[model samples]
Target: MIHGCRAIKRADCFHSKGHRNPCRSSSNPYMILFGAVEIAFSQIPDFDQIWWLSIVAAAMSFTYATIGLSLGIAQTVANGGFRGSLTGVSVAAGVSPAQKVWRSLQAFGDISFAYSYAYILIEIQDTIRAPPPSEAAVMKRATMVSVATTTFFYMMCGCLGYAAFGAAAPDNLLTGFGFYEPFWLLDVANAAIVVHLVGAYQVFVQPLFAFVEARAAARWPGSRFLAREVRVGPFALSVFRLTWRTAFVCLTTVAAMLLPFFGDVVGLLGAISFWPLTVYFPVEMYIKQHGVRRWSTRWVCLQTLSAACFLVSVAGAVGSTAGVVGAVKLHRPFSGY
Candidate 1:
């Protein structure tokens, strides 16, 4: 996963320079340095062995929280006083309240998909050591707590950010902040975000790696790829693991390079998958597994909600796809070259 991220970064650099061939002479030195760095990162022990990833994740979250607070305060001060306003900082003079409300709702729909980590929690359920019943209860409580905490911080940042920059706010709050006074603080915040994303990428991708490797091993039991295993201290690293993971990384890196607009891709994915993965499936599964009666209020409400989510997902998916197409048209492949 780290290797893939590095590859993406390298590709982005080449893309930025309008270079048709990423391996051109001008990039060779940087490529060598990146390769060395990737090797060092890959050598780090697995999460189970080192357990420092969680700590890093925690620190990253804290850093983000700090950034939100700082930006909110700065924006508020710049706007005039802390008016505790939830409406954006600079509303157009002629726009009606109805228009503002509609815009706010649209923004909410666009961003609500960003926090679909409920499915991710399900993927990592095995990490919980308790018995089935106890584990389920623990996970339920943890999910509730996590959702509440995240919602609080998200609301704080959104409200504060809007209050600060109002109608003039950029899509990215950090970018909107720009190189104002104390630019170094913005640099630190961005660095923290990069570190956070590295850990997040690994967390999300590991399950896919496991699933693919398991399938390959099942299909080709006698292949050298499945047979060769080396003991690296306490970790049993296999040849197949190294090869397939590298391949996976390369595939993702190439994809990212081909579509370098990060926000558009994320929007497309979130729009297409968020409803089914985050809301519809979970709600329907719970109703079915728990044997909720078809006519019951809970069942009816859940089904209605699922249907609504499906409609929203379809709309969001269409909008996001259009956005991507527009971006592609605006920025042609190797246009920088």
Candidate 2:
């Protein structure tokens, strides 16, 4: 529409040789998503196909997430083994888990999955460090309760999605909520989740940062990098080099995972990885390294409580993994691509 707008200066192109920006990019994915939605609605006569399409899409999503995550885990564990292997195969397979986690989550299948040991470590760093057995016990319980609440919320959201738009998934998923229920309330809920998404993205970034910084520190043991101080043009900057782009990548990756559901991805990922990385690995590693001494009743109780949480979390992960795997196998080839 702006193309036709003129103050009789058509010859004076906006790019008059000094400044030019043919801004073709649209910052809003929701616009593109809704446009396709309008087209789909036009092309279809009714909403009868909603459930079938949903089942297929959801299955595809489920499969991609678990396989991607497990494969990623395999790669991480593999690297932990052959960190210094000399073979070319080792050289080529030496891609670190940091990039892998982001790239894997970016995949359509694993779009909702984000699990890295680094992520887990950052998640429970403070909790794991608590010296008090009771403190650790509370942390474990909190995580359990959080997961349960998130799952229940996602279940409700799934029902809402199914009802509002049938099997039709939208990039702006919450749009359907406005259609099926109260639009105002859905908008508020939607806003709240976007805020939470930002928080979750921070969770992802810490691990990515750690992975990069660890490599840098290894390469430059006594040099100025990562945590070292550095001088800049007008001020000092941390060698960490953390910037808005890094934060954006982390948040956007997570935001992308959430496109089809706007929120279910959070619950799914939380269920799958939150425990394995945070509680299971930390406790097991700590115990294996430090030995779970029967030094004090409090310590014993902490270990026992953590153990119970780990068991339940493992169940959740296994159940989710199976669902994802089975869903992928059941899906028709080329579906949800």
Candidate 3:
């Protein structure tokens, strides 16, 4: 209890130091509660398909990261481990100080932004390895290249989607592929998403497994015989081998099966998870690593920019009101019902 209290106090001190107004710091949670209602109210739709809009944004976000962000992460910390991974990885991956990344993430909070946090770990691991200015410059170039690529794709896709569907495109993306054969395109998109979701899990589920396995290994002394005997490796692969993974797959399946039942809600849940990492914590880290005294005008601009991103994220999350408006236009609602 005493330790926990100290940790909290330390965290508070860190937040206070970063900004003149810590409370004003934009965060994802604060957005969901505050904006979702107002945005929902304002975006009241009758001619637009709100649900589809939400999905579009979700896809673009994924596109930006998967194609570029993923590369950025790999380049940043290809050989890095959590925490200390950032110094070398950031240089490799194209990031600046923990403080800089913190500024860049000024948008909606999410795990994507936070995981880059492995940079702080770098500092924790070693003072000497903390990145130099030259390393920081390299990272900036990588980010620029990735952002340009991502932006092009995002705009083209969004535009294609809009043109292909006219009024219908937002509700159905496949329409972009074949406006004349939207049904088939829609079916294809649906099938592809099924495969994508399965693949997404395969891609995403590993970290959790490793985390559990590491814990199990740490306690191996308590069950040395079994630990040594089992080559199945880490956190009862059995849990995921059948039930948990299948259950997870099934939940998405069921949601899709009952798209009318809970699809939009699930997306909201998935998207919102990014908040804790991106919006709040990045700022939290920036302040802690460098006091307000250390910040430059450029850093201040970037930090403010990230906060705007957070607001846009809030708009995206809550703008489902806007999303629903789109659905009403389609009269084939995807969500926001």
Clash pairs detected, candidate 2: 50-167, 62-324
Report RMSD for candidate 3: 21.9
Cα lDDT tens digits, model 2, 146-166, are 566545544444333334333
Cα lDDT for residue 64, model 1? 64
Between candidates 2 and 3, which one is better according to TM-score?
A: 3
| Better model by lDDT: candidate 1 vs candidate 2 | 1
Off by over 4 Å in 2: 1-25, 28-122, 127-129, 133-135, 163-173, 176-182, 225-236, 243-337
TM-score of 1: 0.76
Query: Candidates' lDDT values, in order?
Result: 0.61, 0.40, 0.38
Task: lDDT for model 2, please.
Answer: 0.40
How do the residues 1-337 of candidate 1 rate in per-residue lDDT, one tens digit apiece? Answer: 2222333344444445644444322223333343343333443434342246656865886686678667777768876865434445334556566545444444434664666565666555667776856878988888888778877777787777666765555555653332143445655665566566566666666656666777887999889868888887887777777766666655655455456555566766776777878887899889989999997999899999988877776766666666667679776552221
